[model samples]
Target: MHNNEILCRLLAAATLALGAAGAHAQGAAGSWFGGIGVTHIAPDVSSGNLSPPSAPGTQIDVDSDTQPTIFIGRMITDNWSVEVPIGLGFKQKIQGAGAIAGVGQIATVRTLPITVFAQYRFFEPTQRIRPYVMLGLTYTYNHDEQGSATLNAVNPINPPGGTQIDVENRFSLTPGLGVTAMINERWFVDAQYAKSFLKTKTTLNTGQTIEAKIDPNVFRLAVGMRF
Candidate 1:
């Protein structure tokens, strides 16, 4: 009778251990997730020249603008994951009116950049909060507009002389850092920041050179869900 009781107790203990192991396995296997969110990109153009005549030595200050972003990710291990993010956005009203060396009344220029990126996440997985750093690559589409008067200053005004110039595509490097919070089994949120190291130059139809250095830095907040 004592031997029988001992055997029954051992069997019960084994079943409890198996149940606990199963629960842990389920949690780990289902941790993969994806999300969509919006971001704000603040691009600044400094140390360059634009023409208009607001004043001498007057600098153009561009403000921060909002952009929309989408992302999908998968947890490869307990502490590492990878994500791909697509960003579409615009920056308007980058106004700089200053007298040029020879060109009169520098024109106001506007630039818009659209980017897509892929990144890797490194962090320890946790139930509530996780912190990670990301490194990635981005493809950017850049559009720039300048006034006819400004273009005419460099060359005689023709039917196509003053038209807006658009450089549609470019590439750059993306690096970022952020933290993620798991609100529940299915919902999560994240806050992140990234920078783009790309350089672009514009040449007017009149043989004058306008160099635009686009080093974009971005801050983002997003909510996500796991499948």
Candidate 2:
């Protein structure tokens, strides 16, 4: 009798738990959601030559940056959504590579990546957890490029006060994966990872140019509410 009583209690608890999970799901379809997140941007660089007037193999490397981000999303269907991420610019460290390897940073460049994503979420609407795949387009605007003392000292092309670089703005395709877990009827936690296939040319005011492939990996974590 005692064994049967315990079995009945366990089943009751499980039923209640499933009921709560179902209540949390409420399906975000046709709803608007917004969240605040923190993002990390790490560059995976394929450095290239700094052209003539520099070393035969004068190349450069880039470093990572992190910032707070805000995102707004709309659920177009039970399993699809669109998201836009907004944030302040990220500052990147431009350092020497290849022939100038081991040399420290030579410049600082600030960039703002504007991206729009179309995501397809998986799983039933009644489930509290969903995993998603996203495809996005991004345009990164590079500006405020300032050269370091190292650049002026080492480059034969350096003239007058100093030599600064200008990195052209470019567009990239971003593909990503993410998951969201509902905590209750109104709140959830989300985590995502994406990669941008980006490349650009940097021109020095002194008439030197270098090409680099800065394929960056982006990671984000956030808590959000659905309305």
Candidate 3:
């Protein structure tokens, strides 16, 4: 199956399992919560050498993308929980910078980020509003990479035509902070801000490689129901 389809199935199963577990738990600690939200992903992208000595010191920048997000959380304690964050999909634009500045868009790629967070909710458990902090790890899968004609004109090997580029899958540490406002007994609104410290390399079909640091900031707003 497609990766996105696989992700959807995995999340669906997790929700059912967590809900079942919550149904049998007498206390609030084991309760299950699930949410859907819109997330904005902004990348602080920087690169090193599109091609050393040839296109020497050519750097690139990745533009931002936004997508829908889904997450499920299990309350481990009155003040702590574990949550998994998943995306519908993301599309980013790669632009030339520094030595290759103003070359416009060089490529485009789609990404899926898989992340899990360990969160600490502050204040009294009975309060209607709570603020939280979380730390997690993420693995980003990149695919559907395509090159633009502008990039082809600059690349030595594919000077006459464009060729695709591939971005390697990578892992990073994610850290975030957010707040939850209780709407009723089992409903709430959540807003969060997170960042991933990620680095990866991209390889061109012509055998050239470039290293990139994509520390992306994420913003999310969601509505959830607790079981």
Candidate 4:
């Protein structure tokens, strides 16, 4: 009799747990969500040899930056949603190495990544916690390319004091994974990680071109409300 009573109690607890989970799901379909957060972008940089191998051992280095980010999403179904990530501009510094090991910062480039993601969430929408995966395309726009006087001293192609580099815009594929946890019926917290496959070429006025693989890894944390 005791064993049967314990079994009944376990079943009752499970039923209550499931009921609570159902109460939270409310499904976000046809609803809009918005959030704000901070993002950190780390680039796995691999740069090509400087033009003509002027400095045979020369390579480039780029530093990571953190900026504010905004998230806007629309739920199409119980398990799917579309998201747009709006990121503030990231500043990158280019430095010289190898033969010019001590040249320090040679240039600065500002970039903005515009991307849209299609996400598939796991578990029922009413669950308090859900994990998701995403795939998307990112468009990187590079601008404000500036060269330091140190770089100009090395190459005088334009009869000027410094050399200017042009970075072309490119598109890349991005894949990501994340988790969302509900704090209440109207609010939630999110954490995500994503990576981009990107390769771009930088051309100097000196008629030299260098290829760089700026595969960036992105991390974000946010708090949002559902409507």
Q: Which candidate wins on lDDT?
A: 2
Model 3 lDDT per residue over 148-211, tens place: 9878877767834566799999999999887776666777667787889999899887888899
- In model 2, which regions exceed 4 Å deviation? 1-23
Clash count, candidate 2 = 0
Backbone clashes in model 4, listed as residue pairs: 25-126
Task: TM-score each candidate.
Answer: 0.65, 0.89, 0.85, 0.85
Error of 4 at 214 (Å): 0.5
Q: Which numbered prediction scores highest in TM-score against the true structure?
A: 2
| lDDT assessment of candidate 4 | 0.79
* Model 1 Cα lDDT, one tens digit per residue, 1-227: 33235334433433343332211111133356667777666664553553222233533334556767787776666655667776555654444334333444334344444344443444444445555677667666555556546544443333464634444366777787776665556666677777877666554444434456566677777777877
Error of 3 at 140 (Å): 0.5
In model 4, which range of ten residues has the least summed lDDT?
A: 1-10
Q: List, residue by residue over 1-227, the lDDT tens digit for candidate 2.
A: 23235334433433444444544683568988888878888888998898898988999999888899999999999999999999998999998998988879999999999999999999976778778899999999998999999989879978898988899999999998877777688877777888999999999998999999999988787778888
Report the number of backbone clashes for model 4: 1
- The Cα error of candidate 2 at residue 29, in Å, is 2.4
Better of 2 and 4 by TM-score: 2
Q: Could you tell me which 10 consecutive residues in candidate 2 have the lowest summed lDDT? A: 1-10
User: Model 1 misses residue 184 by how many Å?
Assistant: 0.2
Identify the runs in model 3 with alpha carbons over 4 angstroms from their true place.
Answer: 1-27, 159-161
Summarize candidate 4's per-residue lDDT along 87-139 as a digit string, tens digits. Answer: 76899988886677778887889999999999999998878878889998999
Candidate 1, which segments miss by more than 4 Å at Cα? 1-32, 50-63, 97-123, 143-163
Pairs that collide, model 1: 51-105, 51-106, 51-107, 52-105, 52-106
